[model samples]
Target: MDLLEKKIYIAGHKGMVGSAIWRHLQARGADNLIGSYSNDLDLRDQQSVSDFFERERPDIVINAAAKVGGILANDSFPFEFLMDNLRIQNNLINSSLDQNVERFLFLGSSCVYPKKADQPIKEEYLLTGPLEETNESYAIAKIAGIRACEAIFKNKKKMYTSIMPSNLYGAFDNFDLNSSHVLPAMIRKFHDSKINGNQPVKLWGTGSPLREFLYVDDLADAAIFILDKNSHHPLINVGTGHDIEINKLAKMVQSVVGHEGEIFWDTNKPDGTHRKVMDISKITGMGWEPKVSLIQGITQTYKWYLQNINSLKMVNMYI
Candidate 1:
């Protein structure tokens, strides 16, 4: 199984995580990589997905496409978050199985774990308790995707596996304040405030929640590691196995962006999860570990944000 020569299809090749994987694979000299944008192929359409799989006949498929957002967006559009993600992953997973794809890697978030799961959440705690109300719909959709991949691997004897990553932020991230995740959102807020004469930045929630974040590039490397090893683990967790408080993270981002502004915590808003850290022993034991530290990753992300601020603004407007 020379993956470098196999045709690899990354479903969300244009996203932060998918693009990172594409870049890494290219750097690794993978020849025969394939990808399609939403305009070219709507993953939600079963016939369209099936047709694409039939035509492309990819030897490997990485399911990275999904409807993603922060708590505000998830709370506002639960149905779209749930249905759209379900449709996209379902079409891709089912199509890959039917087409006899050699390898499939499904990517999901740490949100798939229960809201009140033990700190440093482990894989076994998956459906032990209720999910956070704000993103329950999205979590349910991801849970279904993980279960689907597990079922196919167990019953159909396929090489389909799922990796649950902690909160990810890096290049190509969504920086829009209204819909972006906490890390990128903090970067944007700090950068904007820094440029605006160090104006006070308002952040959502009490800044008390604890979270773990992985750089998108590290996640991509983990994906490639799994592919190369042909790991048969039905589900694995990918993260730094470290957690930080929102308030501390805010200060870190503020320092990275050089924003000399006061950060005001909006107690009115909701902190979706009190603590959501992944137990990465499974992946780490398999010779894969995150190389990017939070501060270093944030530094790079802020640099990218600075270079692409105008383009990001246009993207937000279009969205």
Candidate 2:
């Protein structure tokens, strides 16, 4: 089926991931793309999602909506992190199955993998061991979502697939320090410190943990590529197959933000995971590659953060 002619519903269209997908679909001449703000459609509510599906009758559904945050936010609100995500994905997946959607794509994070897995985590390593304590609840919810899609693909022979992306950052990313991921949070901290006369910036953790990040738009492209492919794999990892230490990442973000401040590491804070870099052979072998490098993506995200700082501040207040 041609993707352009189909009605595509992107849940959480305003988020970093969903917005990127929405723009890409629009650029590809997908006029029937559909979305709703949380105010208009509470994805956590099952009946509302069902009603929206019945009314729109979309041919395709992209489940990009979820309750997401950083280590501090996840630790503080474990219940919301788990239950809200469970409710949101459950409603959308159930509605898509009921509507008999032609294609369904579930977006999950690399956090679904185990904490102490191999250096380069593989899809087969999921559930092999324990998860990071900081975001265990969020990871479990995502695991459930992935398993749900896998079950549908196996039993019902439906095109229900899940893409597990590495840490993502780009335009429309959550920049609130309390809840934003490590990258965007670093970006905000450095920029704010630079603006404040290069004051010393205090960062959490000992800056020893390693992480792999992907540009949200690159993940969007991968999503579209995987959606159009003829693969039978229900789960695939999307990443750059590269890892960077937190200290190096901090220095890079400081340079990008042009911050001349001294960075102070708080050793008391917990490092969520020692290292996490996904094995991207599955997607790259399928002819999908990430176009944005870490430095390039960071520079672009800093530019966006600068341009939208005021609005982001306003949005952070309520988030």
Candidate 3:
């Protein structure tokens, strides 16, 4: 398809994952990249999305926009998380289909898998059982997006596919405690505590849940790899294929941030899911694998956070 010559539109180009993909594409010599901010174009508005696609006529569409957060944010704003995500992806997918976009890529999370799915969750485990209650609404919306791509690929024979990534963290990550994911949240908390006289760092849940994290850039690389190959897999899992307990992750973040404070666990809080890891054999077999180790990724992420701490402090106001 000569992806470098195609006009590509990344829906959430400013976000951590999307920005990484955009940079990766640019580095790969994709000159005709396109993107717009929410103010310029509301993805939830079908007419607006239709207009943008009709006007831009991008050859490839990457759906990376979504209302995402941690357990607290998701639990508090379930409706927005569900409806906003559904609207954004629905508009993008349908509009691309109507506009006859050459290729489409939908980014999803590991949360799409069942809460009680077998260990080392595989692509087939989706919808096998109930989802973790904390983020079920968001998961449902993502599941719908994946199925939408699957249907189009199955019937219309288009190159629409979904990539489910596990716990991504990197540059441009949301460090706002209220809405950020576990990894970024931990980084922020430990950093703040370290600077504030090493105060005790209180963390939610029992620090027992296990999670797998992939650097956002790795996900971006995977996306580019798929686009270059024009792979037709309906859905593929992108992750490190390994996991660590929350307690161990906390210790690592604490060390990275140089926080010597006592770690306190809030037992009253929910752990969300006991374990959520992806089986990356599918993507690995396709010649794509994560290059960043957790320690290296976290070290780089912490460095970014330090450089952007002043601006990040204002993030809570928006949330």
What does candidate 3's lDDT look like per residue over 1-319, in tens digits? 8999999999999999889999999998899999989999999999999999999999999998989899989999999999999999999999999999989999999999999999899999989999999899999999999999999999999999999999999999998887889899999889878888999999999999999999999999999998777675799999999999999999999999999999999999999889888899889998988899999999999999999988877655422
Models, CA RMSD each: 1.2, 1.3, 1.2
- Stretches of candidate 2 off by over 4 Å are 317-319
In terms of lDDT, model 2 sits at 0.93
Clashes of 2: 0
TM-score of each: 0.98, 0.98, 0.98
- Model 3, position 215, has a per-residue lDDT of 94
Which digits, one per residue and each the tens of the lDDT, describe model 2 over residues 1-319?
7888999999999889999999998998989999999998999999999999999999999999999999999999999999999999999999999999988999999998888998798899989999999899999999999999999999999999999999999999998877989999899888888988999988999999999999998999999999888777999999999999999999999998999979999999999889999999999999999999999999999999889988878867522
The Cα error of candidate 1 at residue 33, in Å, is 0.5
lDDT of 1 at 257: 87
Off by over 4 Å in 1: none
Which residue runs of candidate 3 sit more than 4 Å off their true CA positions? Answer: 317-319
Per-residue lDDT tens digits for candidate 1, residues 1-319, read: 8889999999999999999999999999998999999998999999999999999999999988998899888999999999999999999998998899988999988999999999889998999999889999999999999999999889988889999999999999998777899999998888878888999999999999999999999999999999889675889999999999999999999998889979999999998888888999999999999999999999999888888888888768422
